[model samples]
Target: MLTKQDIVAVVVLYNPNKKVYDNILKYKGLVNRLILVDNSLTNNKYLFKNIDFVDYIPLYNNYGIAYALNLGIKNSTEKYILTMDQDSAISANLINSYLKFLNVNDNNGIGALTCQYNTDRNPAVAKKGYVKVRQSMQSGTLFKRSTFDKIGYFDDKLFIDVVDLEFFLRMKRSELSLVRINAAVLNHHPAETKVKKILFLKLKYGQSSEVRNYYKARNLFWVAKRYNSLDMYKGLTISWLKIILLYDDKRKYLKAFNQGIKDAKHNRLGKYYSNYEGN
Candidate 1:
């Protein structure tokens, strides 16, 4: 029988709501252990008491997701570590299915396993069982402890966004595998709020939030610099250019894009942008 000692779920929470707590409860019986890293400024002691399954590690302030996840992973004592966003809810059989698949295909050099992330009108699915993708979203992904030992922890410099992509890209460069298990599914809440917040985020931070754009732009540059790969640089450049043109508000979009470029050039990252609610 697979015991809780086999797998540990490390979920990083930032001012999490009841929905997050409820989601954790749903998966409580499946994993060997549950570790919750609360990256909130205020102490949520009372809230932590209600969650019997999770071992809470409360941070006084918002330490970027990368930092929080590092803490969770370092503290965990399990063979496999599953890192996820607080907002994500997993299917009951997700963990069991992933473990079974892993056991049978031991030859597959997979560093991480990803589930289908449902967002907006489109559901992100893997083609040909598990395509060799350049990136994987932080939510709904399980990481092999050995992979971290090989690649080191996430870059703390990237505090918030694009950290997952940076980690995955590093694994890709090392020829490690990232598999997508179609049997596992995760429901994600898309940032489909009003156009005002969207426009503000684009203006203030460029295409994504300022924090996200900084990492996206800087990390892309860093990856190209370290790997000396023109293909990767070209792909990211095209993606950024597309975002710049996609916005309805040209002025705000251009301003944010310019700011992002300037920051990227200077390697200014980890600082939160104004108007961004530290997510």
Candidate 2:
């Protein structure tokens, strides 16, 4: 069993809401240290300046999750790092479980441990105590800090979406263990838009805005191109098509999709903004 001091919790903030602050309170005794990497454009950085048991680093811009996470990891001095989103909450015993699992798998080349979460596409492996999966989200994951040296940090070029998948694919290729616990600690669905079931076809996961759509499509395309996997290629085709067909304002969504494809083709990345014309 691992003690609290052995783990460090890092939360990436980008225009987070009130829940984030409330959750920060819960993290106080959960781990020995708490780090908040603020990427908000506004003056939200002031909120963390003198907080007890917290170290705040404000980027003052939307640098995306990957950058903030890398910053947090660099600042951490613990054996294990627990990465969390502003709105993420996990099982109370999550740390204990991770400690147990890692203790058992320390000599088995385990790089990280991910937890079960609510998702549109549920997998059967989640029903088991532990499942060796190729993909796991960044949030609700506990990582062995040394693994960063083995598998390079996240690609800053991808920016946001598919960032976790890219890292997962790389880990899978490296033969590193990426296991997901059956207990669903991090049950979060930030995207509250209702899923539109289309005439007996696949369900459309409603998106928040055009900006998000662009990142989603572009990053997926970029990953698919590099990985050259049939599932990714098929996902790339099907996902954007659903985004276009299911959105209320089809023209704006289609435009974002096209722009994403164009940017990916030209190797353009980092923060890109739209006029919010149709928003």
Q: Compare the candidates by TM-score and give the number of the best one.
A: 2
Off by over 4 Å in 1: 1-5, 124-131, 193-211, 229-235, 238-243, 272-279
Local distance difference test, each candidate: 0.71, 0.77
Give lDDT tens digits, candidate 2, residues 72-191: 999999988898888877555677677776666565478889887765444332354788887778898988887787898878888788888888888877878888877546655656
User: Taking the candidates one at a time, how many backbone clashes does each contain?
Assistant: 1, 0
TM-score, every prediction: 0.82, 0.88
Candidate 2, poorest ten consecutive residues by summed lDDT: 119-128
- Model 2, residue 254: C-alpha shift (Å): 1.3
Q: Write down the lDDT that model 2 would get.
A: 0.77
